[model samples]
Target chain A: MTALINLVYLISVSLFIVGLQRLSSPKTASSGNLIAGLGMGLGVLIALFAPMESGDDNYLIIIGALVLGSGIGLVVAVKVLMTKMPEMVSLFNGLGGACALLISIAELLNFHDSGTFGLAPYLTTLLALLIGSIAFTGSLVAYGKLSGNIKDSWKLPMANMINIILLLTLIAASIYQLQALDTMDLVYFIMILSLVYGITFVLNVGGADMPVIISILNALTGVSAALAGIIYDNMIMLMGGILVGSSGAILTILMCQAMNRSLLNVLAGGFGGGVSSAVQVGDQTVKEVNIMDASIILRYSTNVVFVPGYGMAVAQAQKICKELEDMLEELEVNVRYAIHPVAGRMPGHMNVLLAEADVDYSKLLDLEDANKFLNDTDLTIVVGANDVVNPSALDDPGSPIYGMPILEILKGKHVIVLKRGMSSGYSGIENPLFFHEKTSMLFGDAKKSLNSLLDELKTIV
Target chain B: MHLIIEILTDHLTILFALIMAIFLGFELISKVPTVLHTPLMSGSNAISGVVIIGAIILVRSSGSEDYISLFLGILAILLGTINVVGGHAVTNRMLQMFRKK
Candidate 1:
């Protein structure tokens, strides 16, 4: 039975590696998921019966944990929409960090060997405690911003200076506590301050930089885990900790580079401002087209491309998009969707939205593939998308979003934009995609505009 | 009975980490794009190699343990080695697919 348990543990770890590997590839990711899950289940089974633990009452604890955890997990799984996934991920990370912090604290109190509880253990624990607390609280604040539990973005006069002060204070406190190991109270007080600082610091950050922030928090969680493992002298914990810590650090660096910002810039709350508001386009009123007028333009077009963004998600217009696609196809016009990498709030936000409305995945084209098609497209129907299609990413070098590649919808023969108003996008930029010579603004709710367009399409056909 | 409880308490963190890793791993891989295929796969593969370090530490520390535990730890190290090597190889292959500036 002991041999069997060891074999199971080995197999479980192997599956975990394979699952993570498979996840990187699109083709075999789902299978990788199943394999990883199976590994976890097998590991639990081995642990349950392994000779290392000798409790007859184990069945009760095991069943109780599974029931409680699975039940809560099921509820969260079923309730959360794809749109809320980033926030959900933050919450999940917070829980993990919280666990690491709690375990470390517990281990400190139960420290058996006085000699081993010297400088190294104390320092690692202090570092872990500080980082983990920050991760926990910072993730919560991030969740708040993403979930709209608080104002999405705010600015402070000297936010950077304050963040630096708080960080220095936390570090100083950690150093003080390292030498004063006998004084648990001071250690805890510093931990509290650091944790609070972490919360406030993260709260000051806007929603746009959340992806990288979450990755950073994840790395913190790993560091905390490693520290806890060292304190407890646990091999599995150390392995898991090192893995999470290094990978998370690398991921944070990668994410920071991808966004063209430094880790310091990210920490200093210097990264994102809102989308640019529409500047003075004096005396030029945006031309609005009713359904019939819009269809008249659509009727003659040889090729049509639809662009969907966050507004499309808010209005749940994906179904209507497919409806419009089918209607346009009936008129012998080719229709395609131009998807930008960062089109919606999170990565793949647009794809998930489209998939929910049962849009054919094949019609969704990546930015590179779709960029070539935009030149040949006769009509570009933009549905509630803004900054992604902004022309400033190209023509205006002075613009904040200048370097980011945008879909060249202006190249199309005719462009129709669906918007609620001239309100800025998440990046706070007013798009010139709204002001193109061939563009006609159809201002309303995305779904309503599409419904009206559907009626108009019937009349034109 | 007490010994069993001790074991469970000691290893609780490891157990939870495994569960969380599995869950998060599944959720993430399900949605990766074809463009990110190489990096994502290789990253996860490399991550798996953490098991090797864990095995080494366990084997080195458990000086008083029976031969069975030592054997199992060695097995873990071997498995972890496979992950590190294979994961790095795959990642390098994937990186080659991208056009370099």
Candidate 2:
């Protein structure tokens, strides 16, 4: 019977791997999600057959929890706005972390009850509890930050010092617990401290670093889950957890590379928080263009590219952006969108927003392709984007965002910036791109500006 | 000492499984396009919901009189189910928008 169950688990693990592989592309992604969900269902079903104490009400409790959880999850999944996806993903990640934390606590209590004193069991249990607690609270804080409930700049004074001390204390606590397993209080103490550490660890990180932080928390949750599997000797959980853990780690590295920042730099916090050093533009004067002239340029341009940022998401202007793209296409203009990897709050955020607006994924060009296209493009419209297109990232070494890659919007024949004001970007770095000779600012709320621009284009054609 | 060694020996296969899974995990999504990063994130997040299995097992193995264990186990199941259900559903919703038009 055990061997048969293991066989089923093996098949489920295979499906998870295949599902993840399929998810690497857009065409198979949705079905791949379903396939992974199917694997989860099989794993859950088989777990029911595992040997257990004969409690008649256990099945009832399990069924009730599953139903309630599924109903809430389904409702939120269907109704959440695409603009709020980062927050939604953060919330879901928190719940997974919380689940792992609770599992560790429950398992630890069981071990205490049984008076089990093995080295491996206690070690795994402590690791799970520590990591699980951290992932749970760290994720919640991240969700709060993303949702605007918590300030992006909020952090404890001496945060790095505090974090190091907490980490050291946790290690000392773990060693003590290992040596003296007589009481459960030490376990509870470690849990509480770990939770506090999670909050401080994430609180120090700036808003722009959310993609890396979210990915790290996701990987932490996976590690905790694997630790839980280790405690219970569950092969399926171990397989699934390790897969998510490693993949999430890779994703975190990818996000860091996109910003040209090391993981250590991000975790040290305050990258995009304070005002950066003043880098004087050649001239303080920026050329401003009216809607009519901008429209005229768009009308006659043979090729144009749209660059979007978090501001686009903020103004809820993606649909308008898409509409403008379609109109340009009808006028025989070759329109494409240049998507910076870290453009929005999370990874691929701009892509998701544009996709939600019904823009074909094929119309979106990544960093390299977009830069290449920009060189030949007659006009480039930057919609509510700042830092990602800032030329300072290229030439200004003293700039906060110097090493980061940006869309070479200035390479185009003409540039129209749709912005609300002359304020610096999230990293608080001044953009010389605004003052460049070829650049023109069309100032207004992004959605309103785009609406007027569209109206102007309509009159021209 | 004997018990400790026994536990380590017993975990040898599980350790092997873990090491192999980690290597495979790194190799699996190494070359994903930037466009699919978000969905890839949420999808793997759903897979981590496999902890729901352990939660179920925890609940089953707990005696009826063990109220704390039962409560914690059931809560784990609830949260795990939400992660699995919500993560996958959201990822699918996002992926559905990526048409080739």
Give me the candidate number with maximum lDDT: 2
- TM-score for candidate 2, residues paired by index: 0.96
Candidate 1: segments with Cα more than 4 A from true spot:
A1-7, A46-63, A112-118, A154-157, A226-259, A270-284, B1-101
**Regions more than 4 Å wrong, model 2:** A53-57, A272-278, A281-283, B1-8
Q: What is the DockQ of each candidate?
A: 0.06, 0.72
Cα displacement (angstroms), candidate 2, residue A429, comes to 1.2
Clashing pairs in 2: none
The deviation in Å at residue A226 for candidate 1 is 4.9
Error of model 2, residue A123, in angstroms: 1.0
lDDT per residue for candidate 2 within A159-202, as digits (tens), equals: 88999999999999998988888888999999999999999999
lDDT for predicted candidate 2 compared with the true structure: 0.88
Q: DockQ winner among the candidates?
A: 2
lDDT of 1 by residue, A374-461 (tens): 9899989888777678888777765666766778888878889998888777666666666667889898898999999888889868
CAPRI tier of model 2: medium
